[model samples]
Target: MSGPVWAPPEPGAVDVHTHVVPPATSFVERLTATDPRWARLVRRADRDDVADVVVAGRLFRTVRRVAYDLDQRHAEQAARGLAGQVLSAMPELFATWAPAAEAADYCRAFNEWLAEQVVGYDGFYCGLGIVPLQDPAVAPELLAEIGRLGLLGVEIPCATPDAPLHDRRFDEFFTEAERLGLLVFMHSVGSVTEFDHAMAGTGAIFPARIGEALAGLIANGVLARHPGLRLLASHGGGGLPASVARLDFVRGMAPPTRESMPEPAATYARRIWFDPLVFDAAVLCLLIELVGTDRLVLGSDYPFLPVDPAELLRDPRLPDGLVDQVRSENPRRLLADAPGTKHEE
Candidate 1:
């Protein structure tokens, strides 16, 4: 708890998971390029004037630019910032996410561009491909292209509000992902929509629903069948370890999920990896204790959550060397084990 609390992975150890929204891309680029003038501009723009929300409707009209400055220059700005941050925190690692929805062609363009723009940097970046899950038939082709591009994995949203992760339609996508040796990344909200998250605050904890869907997918035999396909849930799997019992208790009622595979709720934790964005030292310790260190990786949720991943790894609350594995080694293995990936850059 003394002396800087956490030192991010010696600059270049990639932060395995995070989101890149409009401003994030902007800020990241600005910071990475060390644009002093732009940095000062960002500093001034950084202040958020949170507006009042109507409690009943849960509506707020916050004033801010939704478009990121990075996108304007074909992400030239974002690349500069992200690359700098990766190098600054841990040059040994980087993060990845799938591209836009019209993936059949754009997916290829994005992946190739990503590899050329990012991964080709060699030790600078690696990526995952995003396919239009709405059209499963084309996914494999994109996955094939993703592999050809030397990208690391494919990112698919687990569930949207209209379609839960268990929706049979998504099964084909999972099957293809497994077949390609591509890992399935259930980006937290990918499992389900934010019906409850809208309630705000304290509701965020306890039986976190997103975590349950992730567990449900694994226990329902998704992971069982695709054992080789690396499956990871972002943001500490949205409280995965803690919700196991509850998930099991609910899933126990469904015979299909129960009979599919695995003995109990425990199987999901064993099969899937959880990113370290839980944001609590004690909770992180609990996750390691529940799922073991290998299943946990550093998901900084950077530029979003104020939490510093490097600091979480260094917390006195967890066992020694846990941080190193979470930040450096675990991700290395995750990317290493991913299929169709050629480990470019």
Candidate 2:
């Protein structure tokens, strides 16, 4: 068989789903020394080269240098043909179960650290600040600070302890994000306890959780109400495209679903953006068929092996133009449209 048609990426192509961590020693020292409240809530296991962060009793192990080492990350980006990497705090750092004020402080520190990491790497690095969604009222102020710090947008989880993202309490935050043109990069890392049992063995259930979260957002009219919101769903939108037929079937048969959702799930799915991390040619083709080329962007889940866009781009099934769009044009478009971003012509 012939090799896949290839196309060079445009300058400044972006990887939208990478993560960053605060310097382990400094983060632990700052919280422990300055704030007793946060000190009690966080724990650390420090090794020579890496640290394991335990927040609210959940362990995130072995955060490596690639998470915060700019030289290493830049070298990796250069090797992978990425012009920029969009950085968000690792999802475990959210700590939404803490008291609202404490959560805000934790999120603030993470955001500040992210801002510092992105400094001097203007065109090659863009940071997505974290917000304390447990306190919805505080989100707007934090988002404004993110913009002030020259970060690109905000990264939020699919669900919090209190509610899924569609709940009315989050309406103000979503509205502000839409009004400001912020890119709402929705990611999931199994924060919900019920999912712990359901997702117990293999990690398969994590992506499914993302699908459920997207379903809630669309069914409850969040996407409809805020059309301008630039939402990007992680992990190939978590079974969303594959489930559309079933969802549409439910839309026709279920009275409550029909009443709540004016359009089919596939209609709303098309409105949102997704990363090309599905890792299969057939599945990627299905995603493009369902969501269209314009809505898909390259994502590597960087510093993590197994989800490589390079392999996906190598699939002979993809057209050259479609490959080009996923690698460059689409991501550039997403960034250019983000609120408070200074798009260079």
| Steric clashes per prediction | 18, 1
TM-scores, one per candidate: 0.66, 0.84
lDDT of each: 0.52, 0.73
Candidate 2 residue lDDT tens string, 1-345: 111111223495678889876665565566656543232222234554445544434443455567667778788677767777888777766666667886787777777767767755535777788899989899877887777666778999888878899998999999888877778889876644444542352266567878888988887888878878889999888777767788788888887776667887878898899998877888888888888889988787876544567678778897667767887788888887664455444
Stretches of candidate 2 off by over 4 Å are: 1-12, 25-27, 30-59, 191-202, 254-259
Q: How does candidate 2 score on lDDT? A: 0.73
In model 2, which range of ten residues has the least summed lDDT? Answer: 1-10
Q: Which candidate gets the maximum lDDT versus the true structure?
A: 2
